[model samples]
Target: MPKRFQSVEARKLIQVSLKTNDLREARLLTGKMRADLHSEWEGRLNGSASPAAYPPDHLDMTLEATEAAYSRIRPKLENLAKQQELDNQQAYDAYLRKLRNTRDDFLRAKACKPLSVWSDLADRRISKNNWILPQGSEGYDTFVDMIAEAAIEAFNIEIARREGQFAAEPSSLVVKAGLKAKDDTAKDGETILDLFDRYAAQRLAEGRKREDGITQDRKVIDSFAKFVGPRKSIKGLTPADIRDWRDTLAALPPTYQKAKAYEGLSMRQAAAKAKAIGAKTISPVTVNKHLSTLSPFLGWCVTNAYADRNPCDGLFFGIVKGKNPRPPFSKGQLEKIFASSLFTGFLREGQEHKPGIQRADDWRYWIPIVCLFTGARVGEIAQLRIEDIQLDDGIPFLLIRHDESTGQRTKSGASRVCPIHSELKRIGFLSFVERQRSRANGKATCQLFPELEPNERGHIGAKPSRFWRDYLKRIGVKSGNDGLGAHSFRHTMADALRTAGYLDDEIEVALGHNQKTVTAGYGRVRQGTVKRINTMLEAITHSYISFSK
Candidate 1:
């Protein structure tokens, strides 16, 4: 009787209601109303009463199941309508209202439209102060969905920040002692696989965004593989077992301490190999990073109940001192490294991809010059694509970034435009990059120096071990603190800035380090102090290397 029932949905309700002489309408309407009230009652979705889109083939079947069940109760509704005919308009009105609510409930759950809205709504809620995600509640569904859709999963990362307090669920101790499994099935066992899986999965899930997480998992797996003797469980892992592994590794020098851990294995090996070449001690920072990668894996085993304790905990070995790290080469040493043609091993008589001439370095024998000139990190150089270099600018410059391997980012986590050294233009550095661009099949990002492949080490591009060692000797570098190492170029530039009257803080920023100088006390790099250092460095270099505006 209401004018609202005249629409297509209303007409269909009347027809379906009359299909079995109104026999099924009463029961069908009542069932739908009950379901509507129970599910998504709080979700306030108001739109034209229409069936929303359901998931493909799978949801198609669920929709049909609900519809089929509705048909079975058609006759009951028809009988109720006839019996209650005296109150026809009032009873029909109530049934129609119930039908709308029931249909709306089915539409929402079956379609998952509410999920998208909830995702948006939940993110807004998380922005509130101290809003921790609900672990396993209906509210958690939205958070989980956001992680699934986002490229970087931040869910598990929230757990890792509370590292110190994290303990076996019921215990308060940080020290790992004998622990029993919380699960009934594993009540007799000494370890908990379920907790281990939960922690590892969280670490693995967050691995995409956090590089540290990947290394953590890797350490856990490697340690587990060692302790299990192949593929056993924590029941077999013991303190003595870990000690033996440590003793074996200790017998060998910590070879990986200087390895180019970030650029991959070949560079890392070259770092260890450089020591024999008379380079000073490989950096402990490098060693520390590798240990960092290894340490968390050890921690996860105990924390997750995979093992009773960390074998690496308080495990101390002789770490090389800080003074041993490569110091900056002086002005005279830098010039010699750049000018010496004898440094290149070049190609031998029988090499497969031999060069016609003996030009051993990339960047026209001046790549090191530009890098030292700019004080740009190796990774920043490695990430430079053809487009990233504005070679056409009358005043050429580089767009530096903290871009990880993904290439979507820049360093410092911000895009910084740095002016190219005037010397770069006069020395034809940009031209060499242009030549590398034309001759190569791929982009400049594929490889910076044509002489070096992606994995080659020691210098800009050359990888031959004997060649690398011999070149260092040819450069007149002192073996034990007399000459400089590969990183000396970077250090050399920092020294150059200091000599020109720039503060230590300025030098730190020019070098692109993201750390506080607490240990050093006085020297710190901050603000745009790096650029000011660069201006001073530009003044210092012109005394030896000439370039025009």
Candidate 2:
């Protein structure tokens, strides 16, 4: 019998029965069980490999639900007639007007009761407006008026109960309303905001652990909500509405544009204010991003039957031609960058020019330098644990992986190991690792760069990327139409490798890219293949490489 394994996540101890007495067979069985345990654990942490499709039962509307609601109102009206006391028709008319005004007050009130109460009030308002007053010869005038007001009061109370503003369970009237409700009438007619919440919740249930993506989605969706009015029904959304919103996004000023009066407003609100102030329009790429995020959200609406179709399905802003590709740092720019005060030390206003890496011991000096050779993402480098840098057969390698326990995630959710470039080794990279290890008493879990903490949104590399962007500005490396930034280091490496005659596969492997063809995915890269990649990485040496003491 093998030792039992307890799962903290499931709170259960797993026991395997090998059903064998032979020692060798039992050992083999135990090894297989351990391997299975590890695979299952990793799968759970990373999320399900394939999520089950949602059932379409949510779309069903039974025949009973489809009947006319007006027919059901007759009985309630008859019951109200039996309870009527007022006989003066003129006085009754005045009383009905008062009820109308009271219902209007509830509708326009700043704070509503619970949703159910509010919805019921809205239903009564509709019914009252449609109710014909019994004229000079007609009878039951007071009964009709009283029933309408009763419905309003009953609904207000239901809202308080459902919204958790009160302790009581739903009233008999509320249950009757529910029983008579159509799919379209239920849940206050499924507003766009309601669908957005459901979409976000479904994504979370599907094991989406990152909030950054959802936060971005909310920004786009919230702007749409503000445009359409929060209570607008999903059924009311049209292609025209989407087009109008798209145009609004296009005319909106860049998010970074600022005005003193709009300081505390949301990004969308600030953009609107800035636009009114005649600020410059945002880039087409940004407008496109808004549409792209919106497309999927609307698609989800369609899937869940909230909408007949996605309004944003076929819309796109045309990107202008000849935009400056984020070009690789020119050879001259690279030289100036490494030789700047950031590397060699320089002075500022009222301050001494502190020279060398020691004065700037954080990401300011190291992240870019590491990026220059390895072409690793600022995020991948920033979140690195000490163990991520390891010696494989006497060659140092950088391991980029997604570890949920450490709140570390990879862009593609795939892990890769790249050999440390020889240039990085010569520049005291190993020495820095040694110091970090000694400081932590040789603990491999220590961060390679402890100074860089995760940002408010929990992205470990977000602030570091900003720091690098500011550094670029300091060195006069403005991000132009070419889309150039820290990521251009990757393009620079790929270009250098191509110039050195490395195959595309070797470059792709070194850069942590997916092997393009089906054949490339058949098996693991040969050890000899890695040796070739390491050679290609070494060839990235510069015409102006200098990191001396």
Clashes (backbone N, CA, C under 3 Å), per candidate, total 24, 7
Best of the candidates, lDDT? 2
Off by over 4 Å in 1: 1-224, 227-239, 253-291, 301-309, 318-321, 342-364, 391-394, 404-415, 437-453, 456-470, 474-484, 515-536, 542-549
- Structure candidate 2, residue pairs in collision: 117-159, 324-481, 324-482, 325-482, 326-482, 326-484, 346-353
Tell me the tens digit of each residue's lDDT in model 1 across 1-549: 234433323233322341223323344344544455333322323442333432223222222222222222334444554665435667666755554554455355435644344354444434432344454555456343332222111111212222333331312111011111111113222223333334444554454224344434455455435433343345444556555544433332345433453234333344444445655443444444544554565577677656666655565456765663657766566555554553233454333123344553354344456667777654455455666676332556676654545443433455555567767666677776677678676465645544544332113233432333345664455474343444556677777777788877766666665546565345442345334533655676645643321
lDDT of 2 by residue, 1-549 (tens): 122323225545567687766554455456656776666665555664223332112111111111222234435444553465537787556545554565466444423332344335433533443433233312222222223433444444433433457665434342344333333232563666557655765675565534567767887888787777665667667788888788767776665535456666755576577678887777778888888888888888888887788888777787877855656787887877787777776454212123433445556668888888887788898988899998777789888877777777777556777788887787788888888888889899989898889877778888867666666765676654446677878788888888888887767777877666777657765223445557778777795756752
For each candidate in the order shown, give its overall lDDT on alpha carbons: 0.46, 0.64
TM-score result, candidate 2: 0.64
